[model samples]
Target: MKVLITGKGGQLATELIKVFPNKFDVVALSSHELDIVDAESVERSIAAVKPAIVINAAAYTAVDKAEDNQQRAFDVNYLGCENLAHACKAAGCSLIHVSTDFVFDGKKATPYFVDDVPNPINVYGASKLRGERGITNVLEDAVVIRTAWVYSGTGNNFVKTMLSLMQNKPELSVICDQIGTPTWANGLAQFILHIASKYGEGERQSLVPKPVTYHWTDAGVASWYDFAVAIRDLGIEKGILKQAIPINPIPASQYPLPAERPSFSVLDKTETEGSTGFKTTHWRHQLDKMLDEYTEDSKLSEGKT
Candidate 1:
């Protein structure tokens, strides 16, 4: 099987590569190698590789920054996805598009389901919803997987931010009102592969089958404050840190930012778990695993054999 992935250097894309190392003939591209915003460049890359499957991992992920720079975010997140979808259609390849929970307005008391309608309040969510629409509209065999609060072994994410904040501040202030699940990049990446690979089997058949979208993340939900507390607790459990100042919970208003965030952004996993046949780890378990890896990495970097 030949699979091509975008955003070569991102945390989620990097995890997909790590988990599926040498399993398939893989062609990974950074934005520099193939800019998604440029139509001709995207077409050329897709034609050159001729992959059986294409995973759209490249995205405009700077949420707060996007409030100030809407055009660039739309250019990359919306227009870029349109390019990928069109390329997939022209190449006769099945496409898997990564999306975010931000697509919803966070009005529901329950978790967002695959069937739920999206009502985005922010530019970042609006752009991503456009990306989802682009992929689903262009490709009959495409899969759109929406995830939340993704962190990985590579790249900047919430876990690393908490660790850094604890070291510098006497007390860390986090938003306790906004609730969502924190997903390990590996969990979501693997889930995408299982869905993409299976769905591709009948993609080019004589009769087109129904296209599907799925939602996935770690099992449990927590607010940003809860996540930070768990991160610090895990670090202590793993013996990586002797001590750190406790993290404090504050309402969303206490820490104001450019972008507006959803108060509740959890996603339902009924369809995703059913299709993938892989159970997602609880957020707490994932947190421990990440902390352990961080501890090992720190030791290695310090030249500790």
Candidate 2:
């Protein structure tokens, strides 16, 4: 199968390329290489590549920055997706769009299900929601997967930020009230590949009889404080950090940003699990795996030096 992936250098995109099966022909493009926001460029690229499926990993992910730059956010997250959907339709191919858990207002005490109505509380979330709507409106069979708290060894994510802070600072403060599950980009990448393979093999009906949204994240939930604690402990154990530091738990009000985040953005993955026949791993466990990879890579780099 010929697969085209956007946002080639991103955490999720990098993982997708790393874990992709050798049987598939993958064409991964960075934003500079294939600007998704440009409708004409998207159409031309899809026509030239003629991929069997276009997996859109491109997105404007700056949550707080989106508040100040709504136009750029919508151009990338919303219109970029619309362009991809239209281009995919023209090319007679399918689309697999990655979305986010922020679409929910975080009012629900429990997990947000696939069919739950979205009420985004921030510009970033609202833009992503609009992108999701654009995809479904343009293409009937496109797959939309919403994930949360994603991190990988290669990107600027919560895990890396926490690790860096733990090494440099004597203390850190993290929000304890906001809760959600962390998703490893590697795991999410594998799940996406599974869906693409199924679709490419003419097993789309088994996965999705119609257009659907799926929620996927690591199995367990935790607050930012819990996540930071785990990162601190794990970093020390893996020799990624020299010592432990005090991590203080704080409410969101104590440290405010331009964006209003969902207090409880956990997503329910029951349908995704059943459809893909893949079991979800716990967030801490997935973190350990990623740290292991990071540790090994760090050692290799040191050796090279």
Candidate 3:
């Protein structure tokens, strides 16, 4: 079985490779190897590898900055995906496309299901939704997985940012307005690779390598304030920090940003449940597992040996 992955440098791609490095003839390419912005490069790379399965992890993910860089964002996210989808279709290969939940407008109180219409409020979100459309339009055998609030053992993410600020500042202010499910990149990588492998074998008779999509997110919803505070509290309890000061909660209006984020972006996993017959790990469980690596003392003290 052969698998090709774009965005070799991205956080999620890094975790994906780590968890599933042995699963296939893994070809991990970064921007330097195959610039997604250049259709020629994308085509040439795809033609050269012709892997049985392609996992596209590349994207223009800068949220606030995308407001001023719409063209750049669209070029990389939408057009690049178009290139990839077209290439995969030509090769008769399956594609596993990753997407963001920022595509929603955050108007609903409950979780957004797979069938909900995407109404992006920002340039980044719009670009991602456009990319999703591109994949669906171009590829007959594509699996779209939309996820949110992702973090990993490596990378600059919410958890790392919270830990950094907690160490440097006496107190911090985080907006309480935005809420979403946090998905662990490692866990997601495992699930996707399992499907990718089956795709290679042409098994999973009931599942579609064709025009299918699912929402994959960790269990439980959390406001940005809630997530940040939880991290600080856990850090203190685990003795990763000498002390954790108060993390102040502020309204979204009080802390304005360049991008208009969805106040809510929770994704319902009913489709994922039906397909995978498994549920995602809870956010607390995922975070605790990652945090444990930083607290070997806590592990030993708790007699986890």
Candidate 4:
């Protein structure tokens, strides 16, 4: 099956491109290749690719910035998804729209389930929720995967930021109140491909269901402070960092941002695991895997030089 992936340069898109070609005819497009917000552009791209599966990974991800850039956020997150859904429908292709855990306000103590009522607390979350609605409204069969706290070897994310900050600063402050699972982009990419494969097999058998939403994250949970401390310790153990960096846990109020975040947004993946018949790696293990990979790649590069 031919697969069309948007947001080529993103962390998840990059991982998808790396793995997709092994199983499918992949057509990956960056923002330069396709402007998802423009209906004409989306239509033309889908028509040209004629993919059996269209994965819309592009999104406006600036959580804090979205507060001041509501229009742009809505344009890209909401309208862009609507356009992609319509294009996929016209092209008779299934869609895999990536969403976020931010859709929920995070007041619940337990992990969020797929059917939980979403009451987004910030503009970014609201826009993403709107995007989810737009896609489902247009294409009921689209698979919408809501993930959280994503990080990868190559990306602007918590892991990368913490590593950099630890190297330069003696002490770093992280919010202890905010909690969620840290999903590895590569792992999430693999899950998406697995779903696509299941969908393909379902074309011939009753293996996969049509147009469902799922929450995926690395198993287990951690606050920002926990994540940073782990990153620091793991970086040192893996030789990614030269020295230990002290991490100070502070409340969210200590460090103010333009946008408010859910205090707890961990997603329950039991249903997703049951559906796929495979369990996801724990977030700590995922972190170790990425850190190990990063270390090996860096050593290999240094050796070549």
Q: How well is each residue in 1-305 modelled by candidate 4, as lDDT tens digits?
A: 89999998998998899777566999999999999999999999999999999898899999999999999999999999999999999888999999999999999999999999999999999999999999999986888999999988776998889888999997999999999999999999989988888877864135434568889999998999999999999999988899997788999999999999999999999998987775899999999999998888878999999
lDDT, candidate 3, 100-140, per-residue tens: 99999999999998889999999999999999999999987
Clashes of each: 0, 0, 0, 1
User: Candidate 1: global Cα-lDDT?
Assistant: 0.86
RMSD over all Cα atoms, model 1: 2.1
Off by more than 4 A, model 2: none
What count of clashes does model 2 give?
0
Lowest lDDT 10-residue stretch of candidate 2: 205-214
What is the per-residue lDDT of model 1 for residues 1-305, given as tens digits with 9 covering 90 to 100? 78889999999889888776465788999999989999999999999999988888899999999999999999999899999989888888878889999999999879999889999989999999998998788888777889999997688999988887776778888899999999999888878776655644653443226557788899998999899989888877777656867777899999988889989999999776875677888999988887787788888989964
Better of 1 and 2 by TM-score: 2
- The most accurate candidate by lDDT is 2
Poorly placed runs, candidate 4 (over 4 Å): 203-210, 301-305
| Alpha-carbon TM-score of each model against the true structure | 0.95, 0.98, 0.93, 0.96
- Kindly report which residue stretches of model 1 are placed more than 4 angstroms away from their true locations once superposed: 199-208
Give the 10-residue window scoring lowest on summed lDDT in candidate 3: 197-206
TM-score head-to-head 1 vs 4, winner:
4
What TM-score does structure 3 among the candidates reach? 0.93
Clashing residue pairs in candidate 3 (N, C-alpha, C atoms within 3 angstroms): none
Write one digit per residue (lDDT tens) for candidate 2, span 67-147. 999999999999999999999998999999999999999999999999889999999999999999999999989999999
Pairing residues by index, what is the TM-score of model 4? Answer: 0.96
